[model samples]
Target: MSIQLNHTIVAARDKETSAKFLSGVLGVPVGPRFGPFVPVEMSNGVTLDFIDTGGEPITAQHYAFLVSENEFDAIFGRIREAGMAYYADPHHAQPQQINHRDGGRGVYFDDPNGHNLEILTRPYGSGPP
Candidate 1:
């Protein structure tokens, strides 16, 4: 049998808040709680299980999602409507702008937990870089 990513633990100050935030942004439902974790499953069947940090220092992590053009538009619109700051680059060099990389649109933004979240219409390295 082939191995695949099933789930990952995401450290958050509040599991419910983080799970809800991600679910809302991705337009997906937050999964039922399992023990101390509040899960949000992606379309690929991988789950991001949010758990409280319990006073532990949380380090930022980057997560990138490849979405369709329509999904990107809907998600980006939610980002804008929420008044969240977004950058065209991962380093945040370009403010309030989206990048046209790999011949598709992409944007980087920070989640409430300070995790770097990226959404793009095309997969990186799929075309001319």
Candidate 2:
């Protein structure tokens, strides 16, 4: 059996706001509801289940995405336009710059729920320049 990620639960103070924010940034629509989860499907067949926490403070979680260069540019533009800081590293030291890790470009930022969001063009520690 080949193992693949099915979905992940994203805790949000408000599912509607979080779903809308993610849908806007990712350029996708949040469609249909399933039980307590607001299912947001991606083009890649992955779903992010947004769970409402009713203003309860949530611990920050890290989520990384592998996107094309053009997608990176567009997402970066959206991040900057939203007035949020982007970093080359998870520590947010090199703000507004992409990192040259694994011989590919990578950037890091956070979502409204304080979830660390990362975009990279290559897999971690793999591939050539």
Candidate 3:
């Protein structure tokens, strides 16, 4: 069988809160708890299993999501409504702007755990520059 990413553990101070935050942003439901994990499953069947770190410092990680235009709108709306700061580029040089890279919209924001989250309507290099 081809190798696929089935699940990954997302370290958070509060697993439930982190899971709910991600679910609300993505407009998807968080799955029922399994042991120490509160899972948030993506459309591709890959799960982001949130685990409590019990006050441990979380090393920020970057997660990029390729979403449709409609999905991007909805998710971006939520981001703005939450007053979350976003940037057009990954380096965060351009504030309050979205990038039209590869002929699609893209933005980068940080999660509660300080993880860099990116949402783009197109895959990089998939279209004309």
Candidate 4:
């Protein structure tokens, strides 16, 4: 009886590549396409539907995921293994490092579409911000 986010469209250069890239990094599966969308379903049941920019300029956006400590470890490992540049802060002032903000570990990285992606073990402001 409450409103929930069912899905969101993510602009990308190549939908399939972006969707698969996110899936691989998050250790999730890319769902079957519905029309032009290539979806990546999260554990919370919300889906990130990736779509092409259609010859338009793709504006980069930020997307963050909350994960368990173990999940963070796995995801962070994949990020490093992929040789992706990661930062401790959203502004990317700290490279190859993670922030211990709000008493939790967090890292930021960029996707194929230049979307700033973040993974954290704790929600922001859950502790001292």
Each prediction's whole-model lDDT (CA): 0.93, 0.86, 0.94, 0.95
TM-score leaderboard ranking: 4, 1, 3, 2
Clashing pairs in 1: none
- lDDT (10s digit) by residue, model 4, range 1-129: 999999999999999999999999999999999999999999999999999998799888999999999999999999999999999999999999999999999999999988999999999989964
> What would the TM-scores of all predictions be?
0.96, 0.90, 0.95, 0.97
- The per-candidate count of clashes, in order, stands at 0, 0, 0, 0
Candidate 3 clashing pairs, residues 3+ apart or interchain: none
lDDT of 4 at 20: 94
Q: Give the least accurate 10-residue stretch of model 4, judged by summed lDDT.
A: 120-129
* Candidate 2 TM-score, true structure as reference: 0.90
Q: For candidate 3, what is the TM-score?
A: 0.95
Ranked by lDDT, the better of candidates 3 and 4 is 4
Off by over 4 Å in 1: none
For 1-129, candidate 1 gives per-residue lDDT tens digits of 899999999999999999999899889899999999999999999999999999899999998988999999999999999999999999999999999988999999998889999999999878854
Candidate 1: worst-modelled 10 consecutive residues by lDDT:
120-129
lDDT of 2 by residue, 1-129 (tens): 978788899999888788888888767799788999997887788889999987788998998888887887887788889988889989888888889888888889888889988988889979676
- The count of residue-pair clashes in candidate 3 stands at 0
